[model samples]
Target: SFDVGGKEAPKVQLTKDGKEVKFTSVEGTRHVYSIAEVKPEHQGVYKLTAKNKTSSEETTVTLNVTGMYIIQ
Candidate 1:
């Protein structure tokens, strides 16, 4: 969840690897950005932006997917 810190809610968007990613809210809340599933293709840098008429703020995160094997 992210805090926009204002009386009015900010518009939010998410992008992965410089491309726009589709997201949904788990509930009817502005703080949640939900991706239905995670796959190998989903591994990349993700950016979240919150903007209003007056100002904007951004945050970024990296997702790395690794394989795990069971040894016999």
Candidate 2:
């Protein structure tokens, strides 16, 4: 999850391994991103970017999947 610290609402974008990916945004939330039902193929470097009229912010995270199966 990420937070936006600007006056205006920013456009959020999420990417995995340099490719654009889909994320879930719940209603009434500011800037929350979620990936449901994670799988082994989902392991990669994820980058999130939020840009508004005045400023922009971004972050990166790495997802590593190990073991037989993920419970949740």
**Tens-digit lDDT track for model 1 on 10-70?**
7778888999876655234445655567678778998988788888989999999887789
Best by TM-score: 1
lDDT of 2 by residue, 1-72 (tens): 665555787788889999988766635435565657777898999998888988888899999977685688
**Per-prediction CA RMSD (Å):** 2.5, 4.1
Instruction: Report lDDT (CA) for all predictions.
Output: 0.74, 0.77
| TM-scores, all models, native as reference | 0.73, 0.72
- Model 2 stretches with alpha carbons more than 4 Å out: 69-72
Q: Which pairs clash inside model 2? A: none
Error of 1 at 63 (Å): 0.4
The most accurate candidate by lDDT is 2
